[model samples]
Target: MVPTSSSTTDRVETFRLGPFVVPRIWTGLWQLSSNAWGSASVSKIRRGMARHVESGYTAFDMGTINFPSFDHQLIPRTAADHYGSAEIIFGQFKRSLPSPEQIVGATKWCVFKRTIPSRAVVLAAVQERMERMGTTTVDLLQFHWQDYSDQNYLSALRTLKDLKAEGLISAIGLCNFDAIRTDEICTSLGQGVIVSNQVQFSIIDTRPLHGMADVCEKHGVKLLTYGTLAGGFLADKWLDEPEPDLYSGNLTPSQRKYLDMILKAWGNWSLFQSLLHTLRAIGDRHSGLSIANIATRWVLDHPFVGAVIVGARLGVSEHPDDNQKAFGFTLSDRDNEEIEAVLSQSNGRTIITSIGDCGAEYR
Candidate 1:
């Protein structure tokens, strides 16, 4: 049997993005990508999903890029009960769930630069998801981008707006829109459908603070952040280690390139060790929770953030016993000052801004 922890609160916090409400902490499913985390049979995937859903992370974010497997592997197994494993875990979720309103399902729309994804292209993608996952309407459809010059994003959002109007989706969102572009989109759409802006917002990646945070605050839009763990680089594994070689720890080429830039900006292993030391001390104050939880808490307490997305490798791993430590803790003024001092040890020198927000690198 899988060991489990109980949720500390009876009422789940909800953030309003216009007409929609969502849990503040979301579980990103990209780690389940076979290309990234090695193959797990259908049962392993279902077990992982059960762990997350049972552990208070009912919202899941996935995409259409990896193809056939996502539909065949994750979707049908859970919501549809197509897989035998689904029955077992669905029972688990029902047992632990407070009410039927607990679960939220989400996926993406990835069309990189210059690629004008029409209503047809977008619909086809959702159709495949529906057939494989055995669902009719995807709760949220995120527009993922690659090239800025392409600028066809306006039309794509317009098409997504139409889809929402037609009862095909609950909401429309953007994956990597910059501060300015996101403002322009809200202005153009006026009273259409857009609730969240999903992007890379973590302790290590402050690109959102550069102005995106203000933009979201002004627009009344919610932020769904990914990469809080710095692709697992900022974890205990790298505290004393020399920013792992390109071959280190099953990370993707894209992740390696991104982290390499941070190591350079962060003043190498020595400075990073100091940062970890700070986090370790802070964690101790919170009953010895993992530094990972401390890092996530700092972002959660920030303004305009509805939720911080944390990837759970699931079954294979776990956060501290008190996973609620993320919500239970707060960073003080001195904590912020010290964190800032460590981060300033290398700011503006980072290249992550050029790579783009949350999901832009994939494009």
Candidate 2:
């Protein structure tokens, strides 16, 4: 049940997830998975989580695979220190404080094995996630599948749905599933079992708008978009810059991944600069926001999109104040036309035709 009325604060937008409403902007902690991004002090990560909470971006997206280190595996440990408990932390951002239905702690289990996991194996994984996050139940448990041929993805979701029925998981969602498979899941499970599909969607990557958007709209499903900033390449920092070498020491793993997507799907650096310049101009029209803010807002305006996942560099960087500018002003039809004009001329079309669907890149 997605919200129909205006949100309590313009800084955040709300959408329904099972019995709860979640913020439209989610804090992505995938960067914590590796040290490719510069390391930050624990204090910085803790303060950053607090700032994100205070700023009303409470819906969090984390994954077990994202944090490979065993010692400090879960970053939400910082939230525990700041807000005392997961309930309190998530409750503080919701309109109704301490309400059981406000917070959404979404985590995922990536099934990489050639064989499908059984019900018992899946349950153990979900329980482990709950224990790691310091919560009785996960607000949403997103599952990622690498092989579509393995009918086990369906079995996994069914197990998750059962967990939801048993009060272990509040909702179930998918990550990186394509339109055809998403349709299959919905048909197999019947309605209302799955709430969202987390995929890569951005001004550069409009693959969701092609097929996934229609499928989601037909059903009641919504999309939680990541790589929306192309791993921070969509920011103004890369505008008019030289094409970075693939092996550049300065590039983080995330940056390298998205940069390749940019080159392959978005064409060369000059074209990207043009797109960035257009976004910056649009931002200027509305209190000089930022290329990143304008880019994020563009995705949020898409009808089937529930939220945009922006990666937070824990303690190293903070952009709450700047990110809030997305809601300060709306993109006029003219602004949209201008942005589309640039996209129409780029390699976006070729990328769409070549790339099968939202998750084709991974497959």
Candidate 3:
């Protein structure tokens, strides 16, 4: 069920991105592409978008990573093709609004193939996104590179910086980039070149705290985090239940991925149950908040985190109202102590070295 909001007050917080101020809780559109998460009609999706805007969740993530292997061999594909009409859908919804500028649409350009990132190639990529979104200027263009061995990603950032200067892009960001590369890009390009880095950061996956946090604090770069809820495993639904069969078709791709992390990398199922119990107790202390809300709050409480990109399955499922509960309350020192008591038992700290840093799974 989607979280319904009737509260008049605007509790969704805002953060600065270049010259624009946007909601710290952004609506992620990644679910639009695959039926593995679930799907809805275009009209219903647009209505869902309207509900989010009405509730002050105006920021959207239209950044779809394009993997060439997924596409058919014969059909020619562009980066926008992988989004499954997300950009087109957002374009229509934004145009329908009286003040479209109030909404922030952040798209991405992910390079998985090995090639030289020439100026022309980068310009074409940006232009393709502009064409699909029906906007002359992109709000934020986040770039991702698959192979770190190939150093062409720097060349790409240089070209994107030029595009930002030319007004084709408002700001440049990084997606799934590690702390070492993030520092290199920012240092080579100078200050203010990189506005944000989108990565996976959650209480269960505390890899960002290892080194990424220090680098961001040093360079004044903000982190746009996802997987904060561990694909919904951190919620109360799985609190007392036994682990699901991985072969079960009921699990979404996100669920399977995160389940592996919980069972193998982070901790055992018994330890996860203990963590859930701890979160439930914390939520109870906070005037009966939900476990999901408490987990999201824990991530948002970090000073280096700019926002948490919560996934919305459009009309299929959402939690806009419940998600807003993450704000309006500060976690007490006692709350953190109780939470850390559970985390101290897990591999949260060492997951960085074992997993090879943030976004290392993809590489």
Candidate 2, 1-363: lDDT as tens digits:
123223424557678866767888888766555556766865566567767766777677773232211122222222111112322333233323344344466777666656457888888888777666667777887877877877888888888888889999888889889999999999899898889999888998888877798889877898999888887898989878888986688887677777776776677788888999999899888778889999999998887999888887777866876776776456799999999999998878666577667665555
Best by TM-score: 3
Please give the lDDT score at residue 115 for candidate 1. Answer: 59
lDDT of 3 at 120: 90
Q: Evaluate candidate 2 by giving its C-alpha RMSD to the native, one decimal.
A: 6.7
Candidate 1 yields a Cα-based lDDT of: 0.63
Between 1 and 3, whose TM-score is larger? 3
> What's the true lDDT of residue 332 in model 3?
89
Off by over 4 Å in 2: 1-10, 63-102
lDDT for each residue of candidate 3 in 132-249, tens digit (9 for 90 to 100): 8899998898898888999989999999999999999998999989999999999999998899999988989998898899889888899999888888898989989998976588
Worst 10 residues of 1 by lDDT: 66-75
lDDT per residue, candidate 1, 7-32, as tens digits?
A: 43333355765445666777655555
Give me the runs in candidate 1 sitting further than 4 Å from their true place.
1-13, 17-20, 63-101, 249-258, 318-322, 348-363
True-structure lDDT of candidate 2: 0.74
Best by lDDT: 3
Ranked by lDDT from best down, the candidates are 3, 2, 1
